[model samples]
Target: MAAAATVVGLGGGAEKQHAECLPTSCSKHHSPKIRFPFRLRGHHPKNCGYPGFDLSCTPHSEYPVLELPFSVNVLVKNIDYTSQTIYISDPHGCFPRQLPNLNLSASPFQLLSNYDYYSDLSFINCSQTQDQIWIYRYRYQIACLSDESHQVYAIDSMSLPDISCTKMYNMSLPSEIFGYSYGPITFDHLRLNWSKPECGKCEARGKNCRFKNNNSSSTSKSQLLFNGSTECFDKPSMGAVLGPTFLLVVVIAIYHVYRSNKMKKADQVKIDKFLEDYKALKPARYSYADIKKITNQFQDKVGQGGYGIVYKGKLSNDVHVAVKILNNVKGNGDEFINEVQTMGRIHHINVVRLVGYCADGFRRALLYEFLLNNSLEKFISTDKEKNSLGWEKLHDIALGIAKGIEYLHLGCDQRILHFDIKPHNVLLDNKFTPKISDFGLAKLCSKEQSAVSMTTARGTVGYIAPEVFSRNFGNVSYKSDVYSFGMLLLDMVGGRQNTVAQNTSECYFPEWIYKRLDQGEDLGIQIEVDGDAKIIRKLTIVGLWCIQWYPVDRPSMKVVVQMLEGDGDTLTVPHSPFASTNPMPTRGTTGGRTFNSELEVISESE
Candidate 1:
């Protein structure tokens, strides 16, 4: 910008300050780390504190208290300067009144859908029905864009009119709530400063004073240009001939850029040396040209998913592959590094292998040894024409997927729970061998730990068990993945997308399966006796046992494998499974209507 300035708004009105909000060396407890909107009280009579920030030390409490302008009574606890969030205990069970009342219309901070930064806090009203509602205030996380250095600032969520509080408050805290005030807000523009020799006549003189240039001038850094003219009466074109001088400046600027880039590359080389541990995965560095070549110049589009385009490609020597180049703005973390760090160490015959990856200055890519088949869902759902997967193939696919998930839970040194475990993530190799892919959303836990705390739920809807969705059942553990696997089995048996009928319609899958088994409806699913269909049916039953709503009821994959490979003749029917809030009708005495059309289709297609 040609000209910029900082405007400070006081509670009464606006004012200006040259120096930033840094504290001066006026006191022993003075903090220089404070910036903007935060001012040293009593340091300057001009009300130095920045707007929207109210900092105070009261004689009533042992520590200093910081208050938001809107929540006069609410005291902020534990400010993580790095993470840019503040923790505050809730004053009540429910807040009819919003502190800052986060106006989506106002702040730089925005609420995310299916996600939130300020999770509610719950204080039980045990006396009356034990009505437990989440308390209104908790820690508000500020997610700043690091590349642009986004930071969580207090004012980012506060409203301008709502930012009015008493400047002082008495803290009967951890007890009585108190009121506080917000200072003024003045930091809207950039302030430019230059030294002017005071007694500053030198600046006032037309011969030297550069305050000489008006603010309307296009450029601020004006200078005097000496002309070769012998007469002062000549047109004032002396400044225009400074072209050669400016040419010299341009040459110097180019030389500086070249040197700086060279130094940056050298620094990057040292950084690469420090990252040697990542070398074993042998992540490939692909040029944009290589990316084009591998994907046949992206001639064939694999499919479009949440992350980005999935393209089928090959390495230099014709090694077929699938490449998922993350979108420039993909929210999922770097898939290349995420996959490499998670799946790199573990090698299972049933799990997909990582061929290589690419991470350069501008371009980030991952290269995987491609699979022959797209995914199990494609063959299963494309239509009767593509229903080539019979009971045997489906059974084999189910068992293979189970083993892969089982390996993730038990085979590796760390027990990993593949959060997103559905047919979409399961790929088949050339010989119909199922290889589990996409460990990017996987979570790691230990043997002793039965559950890991998850702040937010991850994984696709419907496939996730009720226990995993809400903690009413219990904590999250590897069993969460087991629950998801159970849903997959139900889908395999039904031969249609599981989520659609369950979530949007009256069809509850597990309950439907449980009802048929109870009445002994031949499992209604036709797998041959002592053959692939029988094996798959047994696996389906075992899957029902695994996703029994309660974590304890679900069997581990180790037991599941045994059940799948177990003899079909002696297999016993498991009890009825748990039903969701909107329970589905049981099919104990008769067949389910939803499965009627799909069942005949699966049988005929097979």
Candidate 2:
């Protein structure tokens, strides 16, 4: 007994860990963490912590912070050392930012709320059984509870919601529970409903039985027997067969779990290969049937447009996705590519993420995270509009749009020119956060040059700057986008579309804005005396500066961001925008690179 005890102790004995982590910064300000006095030889080596990880501290906040660069923030509110989860204040402003990016590659997160996990459903015609199912599944989705790890529930001190983005009184989660396991649930909890039972194929000699028929009054003695096997159906005693049937059910459930895991592994492998090759774009590819299942046969149309109708759908148990199937009449091939290429590489908080795409033969589609609120155009340009957004929201929208465009211009290796920048293209999120989308007319410029090759003029008539339509103005540069952005800004300030044209040859409203600025007058757009007038005036001035016919007169997106952010006192009144009629000087070349310009004419993007 003593020898056995010694062996067990040795088997489970604690082994020393081989890491020594350091603090982010030294307490003394001028003195670095490892300076002249600190030893680098005796106890100091660079590789002290985990491999592929580094420590850094920033002076931006009040106290020094120790952080892992690519890993999740370790400033946990409460931690479960055993489960390795920390209840943190809403870090991502959604839910707890899972550490090591969560390897629930194994056990799926369980819900406590009823069926309401994602976009709430009105359930115009839902099944009666669903009412109680959700109650067992999820706890109430507290609005914006970012620290919702199982560990957080273990502790009760999750921080309350932050209402700075949009005021909300209570908790509200954004997805729904689409299905359930009537029997046993799997580990990952994602079993595609792809299996079927073959009761019709049951053989009589193999002891098969039908769902007890209640129609016929006359029954065979062998069929109705309390215990028998030899009969017309070779049916065994009902009691004896039930145990086998229950066992079969369990076996079937196990088989389904295996099949589901196999399918998931296959799908994940494809996604991994896709990420490896097409690292920038993450487009969801749903089978046609999956799309149909998601949208419930296109029964619920959220928004209709010239190109297509947007149907809201949930892809997974918790993933809310928007499926945009190209309308039969409006688009076809390259137009789909236009959006995919333009949105693929771009990722920003202010921009809508293109999750995935699909282009099976005869089908063209694009998938994106569903933005709760629609376009900014709808709110501002509605009949009897309220204009309750006030000035702050408008200012925020302008800044967000500018930042998005700036990302397209400078964040990517190749410069992206949003040829169509307007109120209609700016969408609002759940919190009225702005996202830029719709890139059918977008163009790409080489990293080194300001000019992009174009054979034919593109973009909406009103939003297109003068230089893009005319060559004499100057080399069409990144400033063209600046011009378009400025026009959008002016529209936001105008709070209406610049729809009126004196003739086919003129852009009436921006010209009107410039004239008013020249005479030191405010834009005549019907805006009430709200506090946002200051931001409106700034946008108007900046927009006017942006639409200057010569590219040189337009401000870069960087400066545009600064002007939007800075106080009104720092602003300079804009000069009159170059009119289409203005005689422009000769323009420069495209720096010698030549490529034929093409327009993406189809709307199918996935």
Each model's C-alpha lDDT?
0.49, 0.50
Candidate number of the best lDDT: 2
**Where is model 1 poorest over a 10-residue stretch in terms of lDDT?**
597-606
Model 1 TM-score?
0.47
**Tens-digit per-residue lDDT, 479-591, candidate 2:** 77887888787767665646545446555677766766677775555566665567777777778767767776666787788778877655666445555545452222112
TM value for model 2: 0.52
Residue 605 local lDDT, model 2: 17
Name the regions of candidate 2 deviating beyond 4 angstroms: 1-95, 98-281, 304-307, 316-319, 327-342, 382-386, 497-507, 522-531, 580-606
- Compose the digit string of candidate 1's lDDT tens values, residues 195-290: 211212321332211112222245332121111111111111334424443444356457646755676667656544432322222233455677
Position 307, candidate 2: lDDT: 66
Error of 2 at 398 (Å): 0.9
Stretches of candidate 1 off by over 4 Å are: 1-289, 328-339, 382-387, 497-506, 526-533, 580-606
